[model samples]
Target chain A: MTRPGGRSARVRDAVHEAVVELLAAGEIDAAIPKIAERAGVNPTSIYRRWGSRDHLLLDAAVTRLRAKSPIPDTGSLRDDLLGWAEGVERSMRDRRGQILLRALVATMAPDEEPVEYLRARGDDLQNALDRAAARGEPVPTVDEVLDFVLAPLYLRVLFRRPVEPGTAARLVGRLLTALPADPAPRAGRGG
Target chain B: MTRPGGRSARVRDAVHEAVVELLAAGEIDAAIPKIAERAGVNPTSIYRRWGSRDHLLLDAAVTRLRAKSPIPDTGSLRDDLLGWAEGVERSMRDRRGQILLRALVATMAPDEEPVEYLRARGDDLQNALDRAAARGEPVPTVDEVLDFVLAPLYLRVLFRRPVEPGTAARLVGRLLTALPADPAPRAGRGG
Candidate 1:
């Protein structure tokens, strides 16, 4: 299906596609003229629209990375956590995803949208935690969720280490073990 | 005090110092000839000795980053972990340290020594865990140590977020809470 958008939107999409293709080809050091040539767009327009190569790359890359990992609530925190972790691993395994994540790691600044991009990616984990609490299961803090689940995954990606099979399940098991043995009454309420 | 090393050693030291200085100055993309010139060393000699720019920067940076944070067994895992966290935070806060870390993140490849450099940095944490086990404390696994302690600190570093005061203690407290309630006898013996 053709995407319904204005001419400018179409141009943007073309440019983004070019960015992804070039980045996927491992042309991380590709200049603006190269990207514009690949996109068949004007170099001035590309520079005027994106301002910097970093911004252009980040915009396209963040869209790709975030697009692949939509967390579905499977009605079980274990399932949800596993799904999230698996999605992360799958993204990391993709060449485009690898380029994007590495570029994000290398070029990300505190002021950049990638910071917000990363924080938004945490929503699925947060949702899972909230669901667990709602069901009276042991709920972990946001910090715990980040450290126990997300951090290890990102570390593996950063190091280009293959996230071994069963890693997610093991992480979830550890999270469960970390919870209080005797579930406190109404523990999830107000926490 | 006069250094006892020979001429080659002195040349290596000067080159390494130049690496740190250039990295700290945020000249991350600086060329090899520039670095050699800055170090007052012959460019050919520099290339022959260090093999590549990345190696030179990593050798110097890893030495500095690791040398400062020697995690001593402080009789309590909490104290030890807290000390380690604080050391990491301190290193990250330093301008020179910040540049080194950024360059490392940028230039790091899966096959590079920085990967080993990072893994080796975890030895201190592993040592702390072993000490905890020896004392019959509810010891965590290497994964737990990486996730619980190192990950959060690294996340902050990666995002350029300030590691707020008390963050380290809070992380330690959470890790302690996550441990089994009744410690097993001689937990470290068989494992």
Candidate 2:
């Protein structure tokens, strides 16, 4: 019954690392016992820390991939947003990340906890925009910009098309300039 | 194997109708065998036509819900685009249609055929704009306009929030006004 921290922290990190490797290698259906053995942890430890195989795998994937790379704070909001869009385009270009996202989308139900966790990551990205807006930067609601800025990247990755150079930046530039000088304040705004 | 025509067509229609009923009743999983039984066809027949359970359900849903709604051409491109946006907002507000879209998103992978089918539906809406442009209407790329115009709607649906009334029309209006005016036709270009 070791907790997540004590001696189990090392084991948990090892298990997470193993899951990422397996997922990247397209071994999604690899046996759970094999993962535990590879991580040098008892299967019970995994089950104790993560309730099910899906939860463990999803958590591992999220932890490994969830770096909040900073959004640029260029003097102009337009430039900053375009910069963020470029970053998104670059991330979607990574084959492993694309595969991971596609796998999650295929298996995760919209109402399920794993999907919620994935959405929380999306929310974190939106929160960064909100942070910028709170600093007196002119910007539209996160939802308004989210799809336009991100869809091309998702479309490219999911459809197996090349992310056309400058497409993301162009979209971000267009949307930012198109936004009203001051968007209507969001209801119940909070980061 | 009998094709869907004559009596078989009627039976297929009946089965698809029953599936819609079950889905509306929030019994998607229970609808499958019942649908086959009601249609007097083998469950395998449904599976054969639709591939998987989710596919069968979604195709049935789309069959029931598909509409050839009109896009307005009110002499002004801005007005026409705004009208189209309003139509999209209306369709998304349709309770049954929303349920079907939600179910499809939940069950399909981002790159899976079902998801692609849904994306194609969205793309068709964009294509209407393309058609208008090709008819010498003054507009930028339909794909670009679509990205901005539908951004908020998609975000709201995917994030499980109610879209604000008038938001669609306002977005379309804003985008139209923000766009650069059509370039003046080349002078003295008598064909």
Expressed as tens digits, the lDDT of each residue in A44-115 for candidate 1 is 999899999988987787766766776668888777777877776777766667777777777675234324
Error of 1 at A57 (Å): 1.2
| Candidate number of the best lDDT | 1
Tell me the deviation in Å of residue A38 in model 1.
2.4
Clashing pairs in 1: none
Q: Please provide, for model 2 over A110-148, each residue's C-alpha lDDT reduced to its tens digit, 9 standing for 90 to 100.
A: 444312443555665566667767777666655556555
Could you give me the TM-score of model 1 versus the true structure? Answer: 0.80
Docking level for model 1: acceptable
Give the TM-score of chain A in candidate 1. Answer: 0.75
Model 2 per-residue lDDT tens digits across residues B1-191: 23457976776687777776666676756646787886678888787777777767667655554442345657666767777777767766666655565565455543443234444444555555555566666555444555556555644554446666886787677666655677333222110
Model 2's DockQ score:
0.19
